[model samples]
Structures are given as structure tokens and as C-alpha cells.
Target: MENRNRFPHPLFYLFPLYAIGLYFLVLGVINAYVFLAPISIAALMTMILLPVVRKFENWKINRFLSTFLATCLALSLYLSMFVVISLQANSIYENWDTVSGRVQNTVQKVQESISGISGVSPDKQLEILNIPPSALSSDSTNAVNSQKSEKDSTSKKGETKESTAKQNSGVKAAITNFLDFVGYSLLTFIYIFFFLFYRTKIRLSIVRFFPENQRDKTNKILNGSLSIAKQYLVGRLILIFFLWIIYSVGMAVSGIDSPILISLIAAALSLIPYVGTVIGYVIAMMMAVVSGGETGQYIGVSITYGLAQFVETYILEPFVVGDKVDLNPLVTIIVVVLGGLVWGVVGMVISIPLFGMLKILADQVTVLKPLGYFLGQDDMGSKDDDFLGAIAKKLKRMFK
Candidate 1:
């Protein structure tokens, strides 16, 4: 009995092994991400588009045709957005000169304002930043003349050939990257199609992996995970639509050019959580400045973003997204940051739903239920009973 007591728990003995396995698991995920990302994204996409496929089936459409139609519909929607954004981008390129001038003027005004407030002239600020005044100046008078005479006298032909070769290589690289993207997209759609077509088989196979006695529980957990992903994604799409509308109307009212383009970009960036929203605000502000917007216009953009965020956090999220994922705030932030570090923007976008699925699995498994509890929101308790609050209380007690 004394020896048994000394052993404590089985998990305590196995903790080192668990840590080693976890480290390898994370390393494997990072290394295999190139292959895994497409499948994971396809799985999520399948979950989102499953209902559409089901509806077609209900209308007596065959599974193959239904899957094809659903995939095409998704593809078309993505393509339409791509076309719109590309056209808007081309418009910006065409007017880049005017935009650049306005941006420079705005920057100058801002620097003057800062100089007034901080009692440091713009030149002094530039010197402190280690940037020469000529670098920021629109006129390249002295610098261009000095470089032109030297270039004309020495190695101009060789330099031109080298520059040309560099441009050619850059173009080739761009084309190759574009082709890779297209091929990956095609592969992802194929994965989605197969996943949809054989979804039932896949589900049964997953269930069969467990013992007969646990099969029912496994199936239940799998279904619950799929439900969480579906609801979260669908609700997020609804939220994005509303955000786009609000942002567009707000930017237009503020007299910003290409409001639709800016709003759509901002709405899309909302996928990355807290960081995305900040980026969207900065983008909108830059656009405002580039459009030669006055102080009132700047204030309008601020008010618009403020109101949009207020609506998103207070009204839309609570109602639309609800507690679908049901993750605690701390866990949400940590997982998002971890996901970003692991897989970049795509990882950040999918992290919440993926973690939500993991939480479901944890809740269903006896040994992991404690982990699920930690991951879940604490709606049942007051602030003091929550994790951080409890930690604060313990610290206070120890100090006292």
C-alpha cells in the first residue's frame, strides 16, 4: 500500500512520454502542413457545403451530380469576388500617381502636426529615423542627375541586361506560383467532392476504428464536431455579409472612393479575429488619406469602424454566432495565436472551429473531460469563480 501510494497516478508516470509524443505531433503537423492544409480546408468546406448537396439530393438529384453542382456553385462565388477585387485593384493601379501624390501630402500634413505637438521639426524626426529628406521628397532632382552621368559612362549595358534578366526571373516565378495555386485549388475541390460523395462511408469507417462498445460514442462525438464546424462557419458567413454592407455604406457616406472594394477587403479580413480588425481599420484610414479626405472624413471613418465593431460584438455575434464554439476567451486567443504561428493566416481562420471540434472530442472522452472543461466558457459561474478570477483570489490569499 505504501508503494502503491508512492506511484501516485498512472498519468504521472506517463507524463514524460506524453510530452515527447506531443512535441513530435506538433513537429509533424508543421512539416506536413503543405499536404495537410488542403485536406483540412476541404474538410471544413465540405461541412459548410454539405447542406446544399443534401438539398439537391432531396430533390432527387444523384450524389455525383449534386456534389459537382455544389462545388461549381462555391467556385463561382469565389471567382466572382476575385473578379471584382481584381478590377478594383486595376483601377487603383491606373490612378496610382494621383493616389501617391495625395498620400505624400497627407503624410506631410501628419508630420507637421506631430512636429507641432512634440516640438520636433519634421527634418529632425527624419534624422532621428535615419531617413534622408531626399528619400521622402517627390522631386528626385540632384540624386537622379548624379546617378545618370555615372550610369551613362560605366556599365549601363551590363546593368540593363542584368535588370532585364531579374525581371524575367521574377515574371517566371510569379507564373509558376500562380500555376501552383491553381493546381492546389483544383486538388482541394477534388478532395471536397470525394469527401461529400463518400461522407457516410467516411463516418462509418471512423466509427469502426473504435471498439464495438465505444462505436456509438465515437459516432456521437464525430457528429457533434461536424455540427460545431457547420454552425460556426455558416454563422460567420452571415456575419461577414452584414459587416460588408455596414462597412460599404459607412465608407461611401464618408466620401471614400472605391468603398465597395475597401469594405469587401475589410470584411474578408475579419476572418483573422482581433488582428484582422485592426488591419482593416488601418487600411480604411490609409484609403481615406489617399482620397484627400478632410478631418471630418477621417472622423467619419473612425465612427464607422467603431459602430461596426460595436454591432459585431454586441448585437450580431451574440445572436448569430451565439455560443456555437463555446470556447473561453483566453483559450480562443491562445489557440488563434498558436494557429497563426503554426500555419499563418489560413491557420488563424480555421483554428477556432478546429479547436472547437477538439473540445467536443475531449468532452466525450473520460480522461480528457477536464481539458474540455478548461477549454469551455464558464457561463454557469460568476467572475470570481472563473479561471483567471480564481487564480487572482489564490494569489491574494497567498500574499495576505
Candidate 2:
């Protein structure tokens, strides 16, 4: 009777089946990511751009033309940024000699400093690093010998054919990849247009999936999810623009080379949340070091990053983004890492908003309210009157 009682719950028997189904679901998602990613991205893009399309519609523009114009505008902006970044990258490549010299100087200075502190001679340091002392010397004799060897190698007909074949193969592969990217982008835009054009129909179809009694609740959840996603994404875009301006001005003042490129990259990386910020800082510092920046320049970089963080956390986020996502820090980090593991960078970028939508759904369902609560920010009770909270309140008051 005790054994019978222990096995009384049907859920126990179903537990293994549930686990197996979940495992397979995850596997399927990972395997089918190439097809699924575009659809998912289109859904998010539709949410973000729906307002623009609506405005055009109000202006008496048809849905088809409105969607096309919005999508083209987005594509144009992206392409413009890409072109500018590419130009900056080309400039860097053209001056590679100067950059390489600066990098070598920085490395030598560091080695000398290490030798002074560790009582190791510079020559011994080089030996320890597996570098010959002559490696740093720009002796013309070594350059001439390398040129001669290259000429001799090219003089061999077989070697020339082999080199040409490798170059041809490489070029072919690059062209193929570019064509694939173009095709995927075209498909994504098509999906976005359809999603926006038929959004009402789509919503009704989704609602119909639920029982008659629950349809209203399901529709509400859908609207709430869309609102949350739209707000979060739009807020992020505004924040990134501000960050780009701040980073560019600060880094330029600090005498960093290629300030625009560095700032653009750092601002873009800000999309990945906490981890991206640290990575951006590291990249900026490395660029500073490569540019042979002095102590004051290093101090300037540190101050710029600190100021940016302060503004983003206290001022911008509070005023702009608010608690749209409402996800706790622990859950945010976990989902972001899991997303990176599953679908890499794109997954990481979209994870927060997707999870935010899930939280909205969970909150509406009685059985899932506990999971929603677990994913949400803590109330903090009396701690609401704490230091950060007070600052947040003051900011909201001043801004509003």
C-alpha cells in the first residue's frame, strides 16, 4: 500500500516523457536554426516597425508600399553604416606599416618594463618569448632575401599554377558566401513585409488556437508581448545612438586613432548587454595601446567608460527603457549565455526580448505565474528606498 501510494501521482509517470520531449525540442531548434532564425527575426522586426507602417497607412499609403519603404529604409541605413566602416577599415589597412611599427614599439616598451621589474635582460625576455633578438630589426638585407625567395618561388611554373588555383578557389568561395548572405537577407525582408501586412490576421489565427473562453486572454498576452518587445528594442536603439556620439567624442579627445571606427564598434557591441560593455572597454584599451597613447590617454579612456556606464544605468535606461523587460540579473545572464550556446551572436542579441515575451505569457497563465515571478525583478520591499532606487526616482521625476 505504501508503494502504491508513492506512485499515485500520474505526473511521476509522465516526467521522463516530458524530459525526453524537451531534449528533442531543443535539438530540433538547434538543427533548424538556419530556417527558424529569419522567421524569428522578422517577427521582432515587425513589432519594431509596425508603428512606422501605421503612420504611413494613416497618410493614406497602401500597406504594400508602406512595408516596402520601411524595409528599404532600414536596409539603406544598415548598408550606409557598413560602407563607412569598410572605408575606415581600408584606411587602416593602407597604413598597416605605421600601425605595425606602433604595435612593435608598445611591445618593446612593455618588455623593457617587465625586464626592469623582474631582473631579466631584454635579450633573455626575447629568448623566453621564443623570439630571436634580430626579429625586431628592420635590416634591409633580410627584406631583400625574402623578396628574392618570393621571386624564385614564382619563377617555378608548377608553383605559379598552384598559387593561382588557390587564389581562384578562395575568390570563388567568397563570392558564394556573399550570394548566400544576399539570399538570406532577401528572404528575411520578405518575411518582415508579410508579417506586417497580415499582422491582424496572424493575431486572430493565434488567438483561435486557444479555447473559446481563453481566446481573449491569449490575445491580451500577445499584445502585451509585442508592446514589451517594441519598447525594449526602440529604447535600445536610442541608447546606442547616444553611446556612439559619446564614445566618438571622448575617444577623439583622448587622441585615439580611428576613433569613429572604435566608437561605432563599441556602441554596436553594447547590444549584448553586460558582457559586451566589458569587451568594448578592452577593445578600446587595446586600440589605445596600439596607438601608443600616454598615461593621460589611458586615464581618459577609463573616465569615458565610467561616465558612459553612469549615464546608461542612472539616466538613459531609467528614462527610456524602464522596466520593460523586468528580468532579474541572474535570469538575464543565464538566458544570454544559453542563447549564445544555441544560436551564437544573433541568439544572444534577441534572447532578452524573446524571454521578455515569454515572461508576459507566463504571467497571464495561472499555472505559470510562479515561473514568471522567478524570472522577474525582485520587489526589494524596504530596499526600494535604497541609494540606486532614490537616484532612479529622482531621474524619472526630473525627466518626466
Candidate 3:
């Protein structure tokens, strides 16, 4: 009788505070991501390569040397992949004139096909859409004339040749991005080396955050998180390889050019749930279009993608990746999109495993168990399910 309702439950009060704190903490992290991205990436890479470092350590190698060797091996493997892709890309670029002409011809055919469906030629459709056909023709003519005049003026001026403004801008941007990437990669390697060397101290530091009484639980959670992260990474690598083989064979059989390269790219893009598949399909479709394949070839590529995705989703992911993360469909989609918004594609690729680690910790902590459950793959009675059940019960009672 003494205002029991006003007092409510302790959890009812504390839960809100915990949730609010976590929200702000995440917001702060996202805001500071630019400064912290290197550290985060390094930590993730270290976790992935820690086993190799430990294996070397077990063989009585120096930790410093072991860490360096592990880092170098990982880097070399990735560099090899990059080199292969670069060679293929260079080959494509070297034949860009032919490729571009083929692409333009294919695109024109597509426009014609589209126009057929509307019973109007592409030019008539453009006119209907308030785009003058003559305007487009004039623009193309003007572009050609300008290029001729520019060459004449340059020859007259006896000046050294220079790339067009667009080409120069593209080259400058590409160089800038490449330099930034190299710098960040070096920083990440340094971080990985130190992280491997001080791995024990790092674990102890994390354990120290908890009370002495809870140190064991904290240690267990951390160790479990690391194991799960490693497992997830390995599973992803296997899945990528599997998809690559399947896709490459199919594309090659269908006579797609650069089958291996296209398959490798498409398989890698399968990391992000739902969205990645769409993007990969569009990319393959574009490649097929540009490769000058007939309609049958396009259908073959689409069918190949569809089958590979079906197997990947149903067989590979569930069985190979397993249920370690246990994230629900809704949570996975939301986390992927949020990761993309915060850190672009890299975020999307790494977000799931990181969230899985968070889910593991949440499950270990009593106050956060509900959040862990919510993020889980369980199909228990959700809020809407409960509401519907309640309404059904009320209707039954009224009828009775």
C-alpha cells in the first residue's frame, strides 16, 4: 500500500539508463570513426592472424619475429590477390577502345529493345520525355569538333600534349586514394604487430576493467569472442572460395569474358546480406552486356547467379558459417545498413562478426541478456505475436 506502483522495479529504472548509455556510446564511436578506423581494422586483422602468430610462438620463435612473419605472410597473400586483379584490370584498360565501342553498341541495342516495348523509337521516347533528339545530335557533333579544334590549336601552339580535364582529375583522385590506402595499410600493420606482441597484456587490461570477482567471466567472454571472430573469418573465406569456383565455372561455360575475375568479384561482394547479392548481380549483368553476349548468355549468367545464391544462402551460410552469431534477419539487415552508413563497405563486411562478439558479451552479462535474446535468431513470440495472441484471448473470453 506504500506506493509500491510508484517504486516499480529496479530493472525498470536501470534498464533505460543502460540502453541510453549504450546508444550514446555507439553514437560517439561512429562520430570518431575516422580517427579510430585504423585501430579497429588493425584489431580485426590481428584477431584473424593471431592463430598463425601463436603457432609460430609455440615453435619457440621470438614474439617480435613471429608477429612480423605472420603479418608479412598475410600481407603477401593479399598482395598476390591484388596483383592478379591488377593484371586483369590492366589488360582490360589496354583494350578500352574496343571494349568501349562494344559496350556502346550493346547499349544501343538495349535502347532499341526498350523502345520496341513502348512502340516508340528511342529518339521519339527522348522527345516525349522533353529531351530533344536534335540537341543530343548537336552535342555529339560539337564534342567532335571541339576535340579537332583543340588538337589543331595545340599543334599550332607547339605545346606538349596534356590529358583532358576529366582524365587528369580522375588520375589525380586515383593517385590520392592509392597513397592514402598505402599509408593506412602500413599503420594497420604496425598496429597488428604491436597487438600480437602485447596480446596477453591486452587481454589482462580488458579483464582488469571488471571487478576481481568477475575477472574469470570477463576473460571467458573475451576468449569466446576471439574464437567466434576467428571462426567467422575462416567461414567467410571458405564461402568465398566455394562461391568463386561455382560462379567461375558457370560463367566460363556460358562464355563470359574474364570469368575468373568477374566470379572473384561477385563472390567477394556476397558478404553483405541481401544488398550485396543485388549489387553483384548488377555488376555481372553489366559485364555480360559489355562482353557482347547474346540474350541467351545473359539468361545463363542470371541463372548461374540465382543458383549460386540459392546454394550459398541455404547450404553454405547455414551449414558452413553455422549459427554462431545467431543474429535474426531483421537485426542483420539493420546492422548491415547502419554499418554501411557509418563506415561504408568495410563496415558492412565487418559489422556482423563485431556484432556477434557484442551479442556474446551481452549474453554473458545478466543485465544485457534481453538484448542478446533480441538480437538472436530465435523465432519466439515477438511483440506483434504477443499482441495478436492477447487480442485472440480477449475475443475468446467475450464469445464465451
Candidate 4:
């Protein structure tokens, strides 16, 4: 009896155990994500640059030197992009006075145009709609006026100049943030270095998670995850590059000032998925407006963006991103939202590739096949209304 009890039925408790484990796993990840996000990012970066590291290793270069060189290359690219963006931002700040003046003028012109309509002037429209002017009781109006006067008196009394002190504080805060960012970046590179140096050992450790018989399958999954990360990263970079080129040419043709800077910044912003497209459009329009471009130039830029978006959606993305992820629209949106909620923009950017990796793992494991199918392109739940009907017919025939 004791021997028999040792091999309990799977249906009795296995499913509940599995569910409990999964719940805890997800909870842990969410709670610890701040510490984990950098690790995950470093891993993805390693996937992208692993080949370069390996190439140097193959050439008999020391592993530490190879990793350092690879990290330097990545850092230089990042710093160059940052500098370009910073320059554009600084230009916008310098031009704020002109831009603000133009914006006010544009608004005044819009108001004039609206008021020009004979029967539909704003005052007439409001009158026709029967919306009365906001009116305060005499006592309330007096109270408000007195309050405002008192505030102004207090402001005049306390209006000593401390702009220099404020500036110093702002500089100190910026320096502190820069230092923190540098420290985090240093940690990330160290993580990448260790990952490169211990790639084989890490693979072996991962393989040990499975039974001895399943090590091969585990290794294959690990490799597939790496491949997906590399492909996704490369595809995104190519897309960004193409966007930059298209935006640059269009802005130049439209005679916008700082066209290259505007284009590069707009193109990079386009990496944020659905939200990014709208942002890119707004940024381009703002750049055009601030540069005092003609209305025709604005229309031209819009047309250029529309065509580029069409080409990107219909041609470039489908080919380049391919079916690497294979997540359906519903799952994709949910994960994106969840990622955004958890990690902000970084979460949104990485969610798709992370989901792709999860899908691969789900597909590989037999117990998780149902999840794999759900993450896949199939609509298994709605395969047919006749599915039950077919089963009933088969049962009836067999019983008959």
C-alpha cells in the first residue's frame, strides 16, 4: 500500500501544483523586475553583440579585451546618437522664443479665420447655443479680487532674485542623475562581460534545468531564444535607419532647417511602436512650424510621412521582422500594456521580443503546448461551431 501510494495519480494534484508555481513565478518577476530588467537588457545586448565577441575570441584575442572592445563599440554608437539628439533638443530650446511667437501668431490667425465666418463667429455660435457667460456673485467676485491683490502684494514683497541659486541646484541634480546613469551603465557592461566570458558555462547551467534526456531540447530552445533576440534587434535597427534616411530626404526637399537633426530624432522616436508613429508625426510638424516653413512645406512633410508609413507597414516590416514572434494582436497588445505599466518605455520596447522568447519556450514544452497555441497565429477556440456537432454525430454513430 505504501509503494502504491508513492506513485499518486497525476489528476489528483499535479495541475494545482503547476498553477501555484506559475502564479508565484509571475508574482516574483513583477516584484523584482527593477533588479531583473537590467539583467534582461544586458542579455539581449549580449545576443546582439555575441558574434563580435566570439569573432575576437576566435582570433586568439583575450576574452576580457574582446568584451571591452565590443562594449566600447556599443557605447560609442549610443553616445553618438545621444549627442545628436541633445544637439537637436538644444536647438529647439534656443529657438523657443521664435517658435512661441510664431505659435501665438498662428493661433491669432486661426481665431481671425473663425471669426471671419459671417454667421458662425464664435460669439454668435455661443449665443445661438445659449451658453451664458460665467458670472460670479458680487461678494464672490470681491473675494476673488481681494485674494488676487493680496497674492500680488505678497509676491512683490517676496520677489528677491534667487535665479542663480535655482540654477546651481538644477546643475547639481543633473550631475547626480548623470552619475547614476553612468553607474548603471557600468553595471550593465559588467553583466555583458560576464555573460560573454561564461557563455558556455551558462548554457551548461541552463541545460541542467531539464532532465538528462531533455538537455538537447533545452539547448535548442536557448539557441532559438538568442536567434530571435538578434533578429528582432537587427530588424529594428534597419527600420530605424531607413526611417532616418527617408525623413532626412523629405525634410531637405521641404527646406526645413536642421533637417538631419529633426529627421534623426523623429526616426528614433518611431521605435516606440503605435504611440511612436503619432509622436513622430507631431515632432515633424512642430519642427516645420518652428522653422517657419510654408504651409506647402507642412503638407509636403505630411505627405512624405504618409507614404513612408505605408511602405514601412506594407513592405519593410513584414519582410524584415518576419514571423519571428508570431504573437496574435490580442496577446501583443496585452503584453505591451503590461510591459508599459511595469517598466515604462523600456518595458514597451522589449515586451514583444520577450513574448517571442516565452512563446518559443511554451512551444517546446509539452505541458505548455496549449499556451503555445494561444500565443501562436491559430484561433483554436473558434475553429468551428460544428466541432461539438461533429463529436456528437460520431458518438451517436458509434453507439448505434
Q: Write the per-residue lDDT of candidate 2 for residues 84-165, one digit (tens) a residue.
A: 8999899889988888788878888888899889989888988988987667756644775576655576466787798899
| Candidate 1 lDDT, 1-400, residue by residue in tens | 7887675688887999999999999999999988999999999999999999999999999999999999999888878998999898999999988888888788789899999999899999989999878776658657765668654755777878999999999999999998998888888888999999999999888888899998879889998999999999999998999999999999999988789999998998887778889999999998899899598779989999999997787567766887899788889889889999999988999999999999999999999999999999866457765664465456547656
The order by descending TM-score is 2, 1, 3, 4
For every candidate in turn, the CA RMSD to the true structure comes to: 7.1, 3.1, 8.8, 10.9
Evaluation by TM-score, superior candidate among 1 and 2: 2
After superposition, candidate 3 runs with Cα above 4 Å error: 1-27, 127-166, 380-400
Q: Global lDDT for candidate 3?
A: 0.83
Q: Candidate 3: worst 10 consecutive residues by lDDT?
A: 156-165
lDDT of 4 by residue, 124-163 (tens): 5546768532221344456765766554866645553465
Between candidates 1 and 4, the one scoring higher on lDDT is 1
TM for every model, in the order presented, reads: 0.88, 0.89, 0.82, 0.75
Q: What is the C-alpha local distance difference test score of candidate 4? A: 0.78
- Order the numbered candidates by lDDT, best leading: 1, 2, 3, 4
* Ranking 1 against 3 by lDDT, winner: 1
Question: All candidates' lDDT scores?
Answer: 0.89, 0.87, 0.83, 0.78
Q: Report the C-alpha displacement of residue 174, candidate 2, in angstroms.
A: 3.8
10 residues in a row with least lDDT, candidate 4: 131-140
